[model samples]
Target: GAGVSQTPSNKVTEKGKYVELRCDPISGHTALYWYRQSLGQGPEFLIYFQGTGAADDSGLPNDRFFAVRPEGSVSTLKIQRTERGDSAVYLCASSRGGFGHEQFFGPGTRLTVL
Candidate 1:
């Protein structure tokens, strides 16, 4: 892809259901990140991957959330037992490498748990 692309720009679901969102980063980029933004709040970092390894998964809220970048390219975020509290914008970003790099963000996947 020419830029970061996120799937399902908007989603509405009942509590306890599962959802999966996808992201395709710019070609040749080696770093990917996931963040959650609630209304009026800044984006909160959830996870980051470098190549095929997750360099940081410390920010994942719980076991119900997981992400994978198997080929160091496209990635998917899976949420289980969704709750009302999970309603927010799921943002995906990618950078050349390292924390200091400028991250390019997608339009984001907005999940609404009703």
Candidate 2:
């Protein structure tokens, strides 16, 4: 792959609903990240995966949010009990190195909780 790619570019759901956002990273990239961007704000780191384990998940607001990279290439962000405040663009990125390295971002998945 050329870069990160996100699926279901847009999503609409009722409050309390659950959603899953997917990310496909470039081949051979071992560092992956997930971020959430609210209106008028920059992307906020949500989680980071180094290989198949989550290296940092402190950015996740609460237990309602989680992500996984099982094969170290593709990842999925899972949100539970979605709230209206959760409406935002979910972005995925990948780099060849760990933190501090340049990241290639994917076109985000816009999620709306109505």
Candidate 3:
């Protein structure tokens, strides 16, 4: 199967609006991750899901940010009450869910909150 993929590629929204970013991981990958990268900054981990359950979510900045991998392959990142500071590149990655396995990253979704 192909590598991870994200939808829309880019998004523009006004403050206080809501948005949903989608990610499609490679087939058979059990570990999926979400990250956010600000301008000139490294990507920050937001959440990790193993199969259909979230294995780690402590990196989520607040309750307004959430993610779900309902079917264990496709995931969605949801944002509520968007803010200008929320503008960033939302990246998705996937791995084999094994220790020492390398994670493959998607092209990312550039979100601009105006």
lDDT of each: 0.95, 0.94, 0.95
Which residues of candidate 3, in runs, are more than 4 Å off? none
TM-score of each: 0.96, 0.96, 0.98
Candidate ranking under lDDT, highest first, comes to: 3, 1, 2
Go through the candidates in order and give the C-alpha RMSD of each one to the true structure: 1.1, 1.0, 0.7
Clash counts for the predictions, in order: 0, 0, 0
- TM-score of candidate 2 on Cα atoms, chains taken together: 0.96
The true-versus-predicted C-alpha distance at residue 65 of model 2, in Å, is: 0.4
Compute the lDDT of residue 36 as modeled in candidate 2: 94
Q: Residues 5-96, candidate 3, lDDT per residue (tens digit)? A: 99879999999999999999989999999999999999999999999999999999999999998889999999999999999999999999
Indicate the TM-score of model 3. Answer: 0.98
Model 1 agreement with the true structure over 1-114: per-residue lDDT tens digits: 488999999999999999999999988889999999999999999999999889999999999999999988999999999999999999999999756999999999999999
